[model samples]
Target: MGSKPRILVARAIFPDIVERLRTHFEVEDNPGDGIWTPDALAARLADKDGAFTTGSERIDAAVLAAAPRLRIVANMAVGYNNFEVDAMTAAGVQGTNTPDVLTETTADFGFALLMATARRMAESERYLRAGLWTQWSYDMFAGGDIHGSTLGIIGMGRIGQGIARRGAHGFGMKVIYHNRSRLGAKLEAECKARHVGKEELLRTADHVVLVLPYTPAAHHTIGAAELALMKPTATLVNIARGGIVDDAALAVALRERRIAAAGLDVFEGEPRVHPDLLTVPNMVLTPHIASASVPTRRAMASLAADNLIAFFDGRGPLTPVNRPVAHPRGY
Candidate 1:
C-alpha cells in the first residue's frame, strides 16, 4: 500500500482547490459531475482515508460500514443534515461543516430577497419586458413597503441576527424573532429587536423571513396552517434550507393570493421548483444562491479543505461537527 493518505472529492471544485489537495494526498475527484449511486460511493470510499464532500453526499452508517478505513468527511456546505451524526459517531468517523465564512454573504442575499419580494421587483420587470408597462399609472406595481415595516424572523441564528440588525437599525423597521431558545437580552438590545411566539410573529409582522436550520422536527415550520396566520398584505421570504417550508403549500398560497407575495431562494425539491410557484404572479424564485458570493464560496471550500488537512496531520479538525467521532475503533 502507498504511504500517502487516499481521499475522494465527491464533486468538482475549484481547480486550484483540487491542485492543493493533490499536493497533500492521492485525490480521486469526480470531475464530470456524474451522479454516483450509494453502492458506488461505498466502493470508492473503501480504500480512502478521508473525503471532501458537498451537501449532496450522504455520509451515513451503511457507507461507513463499507469503508472501515475512512476517517474524516469534510462537507463544503454549512448545513450537515446530509450526514447522519449518530451513525458517524458509532462508526468513529469525523464530520466537519463550513460555517462563519458564508454567514455575511448569506445574510446579504436574505435581506435582498426580502426587499425584492416586498417590492415586486421580478414581477414588475417581467411585466415591463412583456410590454405591459406601455402606460404608467399611480398605482402601477405599487408593492408592499419594507421600510418602517414589521420584520418577523424565524430561527435567530447568525444569519437571522444579521437580517435582524439590518431590518431594525438600517431600515428603521421593527424586528421580532422566534428561535429554539431566547437570545440573551444584550443580543436582543444590540439587534434592537423583540422576541415573540411563532404565531404572534406570523400574525403581526409585515414581512416574514425564515432562517432556521433543517431537521425533521423543523420540517414544514411554515405550511398551510402558518401561512393562514399572516396578513393578506404580508410578504414571506425564505433563505434557509428547503425542507424548512412546505413548497407545495407555499405555491398554493401564492397562486390563490392567500399571501401577498413570497421570495424563495430554496425549495423542498430544489433546482426543480413547484409548477404552481412558476404560475404564480406574486412570487420570486431563485436557485439556492444565498451563500454564493465569490469570496464566501472560496472561504467555505478552503475551510472544508483545512479540516481535512488538519485531520490528516494528527491535529483536530478546525470545525468538526461530530467531533466525538474523531477517532476510530469507536469514539
Candidate 2:
C-alpha cells in the first residue's frame, strides 16, 4: 500500500466523516472539540500535511511558518476571514471554504432573526417566563410590522438574494439591497429587489439585515454613524460575521433605543457576547448558528471533506480562496 498523507481534524466533526478521512490519510481527530489556542493549533499542525478547520481557527503567516508540512486548510464555513489569504499564498498553501451549501440555510436564519426581532418575540418570551405578563395590553411589546415594510440587505450575494426572495415573496415586503456591484436586471426583477446605495438602504429600510462578508475593509461596516442613519423604529439583524458591526457601538445604540430592536446570531468576540448587549431588553442574541440546520450543516461538512479528499488525490481544490504557488516538493 502506498503511504497516506497525514491530516489534522482541528476541531471535532462527525465520526463518520473522520472514518472517511481515515480511509485516505492518517487522521488526527479532535473529537472533544477543544478550543485550541493559536500556539496549540500551530504546534499540532507542524507534523500534518493538511487540516480541516472552521471559522474559529485563525490560519495566518505565523501559524503557516510553524507548519511547513501543511499544504491545504479546508474551512467548513463559507466565511474565511479567519484565514490570512496573502500569507497562505506566500507559503504555497491552498485554502478552501464551504460556500453555496449554506447560503439558503443562512438566509432562512437571517429572516427568522429579523422576524423575531421586529415582532419582539424574544422580549415577550422573557416577560412571560419572568411572570411579568399580568394583563393583556395594546402597547405591551408593540413592534414594527414585517409585511409590506421595506427590507434592506447589505452585501447582495446568494444569501442576500435568498433573503430578498423570502421578504418579497414570502412576506410581501419591499426589498432594497446594496452590494459592491449591482445585480443583473433579470435577477433584480426575479428577486423583486431594487439596487440602492448603502446610505439610501440604511436610511430608508424598515428592517436592515447584514449579509456581507468580513474583511479588513468590511470591519465595522455598521458603526455608530451608520446606526445613527437608521430610523429610530427600524430593526437591525446581523447574521454576518462579528466585527462587521461594531458590537460595543451596537450595544450602546440598542440601550439608547437608536434602533427599535436588534437581533444577532454572530458577535465581535463570540461565543462571548458584549456584556452591554445582554443588558438591553430589546435585543435578541443567538449563538453563531445561522446555518445550523441539520441537513445544511451536514452538507457543509461533506463539502469540506470532499475538498480535502479531492486536493490530496492530485486534483485541484474545490472552492479555493487563494491560488497557492505550486511547489515542487509534495506536501
Candidate 3:
C-alpha cells in the first residue's frame, strides 16, 4: 500500500491525462498507439495492478489469468463489448466505461451520416471528382427527402434518444424506435418518439438508423431479411458497433439496389471493410468515429482516467460495467 499502484495505459491518450495518472500511480503509457493482440496485451498486463484500455483491446479470461495482479480496467469507450465482463467479474476485476460524455456528439454524427446517405452526397462527390459530370440533368443526383419523413431508430439509449430528438424536433420526422425496453411515457413524449416493433420500423421508415449496443443477441440485427423488408427508396445508417449489420449482405443489397443506399461508420472486422461494399456506389463508409469530436474524445479519456484514479483512491469506480468484489477501498 505504500508504493504507488503500477498501471498500464493500453492505448495512446493525451499526454496531460497520462501525467495526471502518473501523479497518483506508476504510469506506463503507449505513445505510439500500436494495436496489441490478446497475447501481447496479457504480457503487458502481467505485473500491473490496473490498466487503461481502449475499445480495441480484448480483456478476456485467458488474459485475466495471465495478469493475476490486475484488479481494475478502465475502458475509454461507452461500449464495454470489448471486455469479457463476466470473466472480469469472476476474477474479481472491476471494469469501467465512459458514458454520457459522448452522447450528443455521437448523435450529431449519426444524423450527419443519415443526411449524407439520403442526399447521395458522397456518391455525387465521387462523380464530380472523377469528372463524370458531363451535364446537369433534372434527375441527376436527386435523392430522397429527410424532412417530414419517418425515422426509425434501433436501441434507444441516451445517444439514440438524442438522435431521435434531432429527427423529431429538428427535421420534423415521425420517430419510431425499437429497444429492449420501451422508454417511459414522459421520455417518449420528450423525444417525440413512438415505440414500435423492429420489423414494422424497418418496413416503413424512410431512414433507418442503428444505435444499438453490441452483444451476442444483437449480432446482425440488420441482415438480408431486414434489408429486403425496407422500401427500395429507403436508407440505412449504422453508427452502432460492427456486427450489428451483416456487411457482406449489405454489400449485396446495395449492389442489387434492394435498398437505395447505406451509410456505415462501423463494419464487421473493420477498418477492413467488405471488398464488395467498396464496389457499391450507393454506400457511404466511415471509420468508427461517431464519438470523435475533439472535446468529446478528451472527455471520454478524462473519465476513463478518473475511473482508475477513483477506484484506487477508495472512492469506487465512476462508471463500472461490472461489480467485482474486493474493492480495495471497500465500497
Q: For every model in order, what is the number of clashing pairs?
A: 0, 0, 0
TM-score of 3: 0.98
Write the candidate numbers in order of decreasing TM-score.
3, 2, 1
Tens digit per residue, CA lDDT, model 3, 269-312: 87788899999999999999999999999999999999999888
lDDT of model 1 at position 254: 84
Model 1 misplaced stretches (Cα beyond 4 Å)? 327-331
- Candidate 2 stretches with Cα past 4 Å from truth are 324-331
Quantify all predictions' global Cα lDDT against the true fold. Answer: 0.90, 0.92, 0.94
What's the CA error at residue 248 for candidate 2, in Å? 1.3
| Better-scoring candidate (lDDT), 1 or 2 | 2
Candidate 2, residues 17-119, lDDT tens digits: the string is 8899999889998999998999999999999889999988999999999999888999999999889999999888999999999999999999999999999
Runs of candidate 3 exceeding 4 Å displacement: 329-331
Cα-based lDDT at residue 148, candidate 2: 97
C-alpha TM-scores of all predictions: 0.96, 0.98, 0.98
Question: Higher-TM-score candidate among 1 and 2?
Answer: 2
